[model samples]
Target: MKITPGTRSRATLATVAAAGAALLLLTSCASSTEPAPEAGGAVAEDCTPLHEFPTIQDGVLTVAAMNAAPKFHALSDSGPFTGIDATLIPEFAAENCLEVKFKPMTGAAAQLDLREGKSDMFGGLILKTPERAEVFAQSEGSILYETLGFTSAKDDAYATIDSLKGKRIGTLSGSYYVEPLKAAYGADSIEEYQSDSNAFEDLKAGRIDAVAWQSIQGFNFTDRDEDYVTEILGDEPAYPELTVLLENNWPHTKGNTEMTAAIDDYYERAKADGTVARVLTENKIGAQAADLYVNGR
Candidate 1:
């Protein structure tokens, strides 16, 4: 089932938006972008995507989302997908009175689909990098701000590699963190798990002292005030990833300027009016303070 903001409970949305706006800005995650945007001119309520502009299909946006995810997408399965893009995409479609067709694909497959014109866009929470721009056309909106970090049940001081020196550390198998963690600590101190759930379980059970994972995923599994995130800053030695200004952007088929422009336009209006943060909050994602996100591309 496709859900539009107009169809959803406005009261609930308002509450979420208020909560997001109330978040204390102790840290800065967003840089200046264009001022919100001017209001759109007269537009038809029953707009047809194909008739309005060129699309792979009329009235339907074929969006490819990763099949496996806990947030920014969902562990809630792909059908009627719910998450960041799940909300953002349909929100825009609703304004244009268009329908959305959700398709689940792996990251590699999503990129392939866009490259081959099999999909209009993919909401994969991919980091914006020059390398990716070489392939897919990136929409100007920001979905997430990602950072590589370490999380532990210890105090904020435990966020460092030296603090985890002798303690057993856990990380997802085949994750970029495995090598850098093992390098900084020791091979024997690192443990790799097949899935995030297992690694987090071990960390909570005290079987492992820490876990090296994405900051976004860490936020999902953890709420401990003492368990702080240590971002791998640029000044630090080269790490598996960098936390400095890594805004995640949605990718669309290359040369799809019309689609890209539509998404970007929607983003500016939403962000300027605080809709972006609220929608992300409604989907149980953070978009405030140091974790702020929007079109801060």
Candidate 2:
């Protein structure tokens, strides 16, 4: 589905209403010994096994996410979570007869929440790195692919890494680009900011020569403000792919094999149905990167 802010708000409200009605119905019928019916009154036998998966709450899928925009999660004062992951989480929960709850956190804290059993999973755009794979099982089929690039106020081109030498660069703190940026430009020349907005602001103010971030993020910034421009870096097809994270241990993944499988199935279906592409396009999140990745695939 195309997930514009308005569409996302409406969809979230509908899902919340449906979940509330379901909860009330379940509560009123609590005196009966019969098992509660699944979301659609009947569950596929293949999907029935997913009911064995344990959640943070009895019938709720608690998710920990960072308030990143577009592809990840976005928070608004007057509306529910309104990004790709945010919208998808509730859809997944409702499909499995569960209510969804989101807890905002900082980067990497979402994964930590899953490890500590504080949340059922990390519902944000997380890279499927080898280090993370050792501790967490990733859902199949990445939801997004990152394209690395640099943003500058002067609309200058940076096609080669050697051109970045001796230049002051800004990157988001705790981002995957930090180590590589420091390695390329030396640690002293690299400045890390707590948020992308801060880094971009510094870039605009001439405090930094350029800002290193995802091409989509840089493009989004430039698209919003006419003062900056972005140039994609590196010869590689794309950066790392993003996936949902669940703890690898028994407490999270043991009986939840089908739950993970179901997620993978949903991703495949979403891709086949163009839901992923539509969301990316509607939000102007990662359209260029997604186009390249999809064409390459």
- 10 residues in a row with least lDDT, candidate 1: 21-30
TM-score of each: 0.62, 0.71
Candidate 1 wrong stretches, greater than 4 Å: 1-45, 48-53, 67-70, 74-80, 153-158, 161-211, 224-241, 284-291, 294-297
Give the per-residue lDDT digits (tens) of candidate 1, residues 162-217. Answer: 55568888876544456667777779988988665677778778788777765555
User: Candidate 1, clashing residue pairs?
Assistant: none
Off by over 4 Å in 2: 1-52, 76-79, 234-256, 285-287, 293-297
* Total residue pair clashes for candidate 1: 0
lDDT of 2 by residue, 1-297 (tens): 111221111111112211322221111111112322223232233343333466767776677766556544443322345556655555556556565566766655666777777877776566555565566667656655554656776456555566677999988776667787776678999998876677878887889998876555566566566566666644532322211121111112323566667677666666676766665555654444556433422
Q: lDDT of candidate 1 vs native?
A: 0.54
C-alpha displacement of 47 in model 1, angstroms?
Answer: 2.3
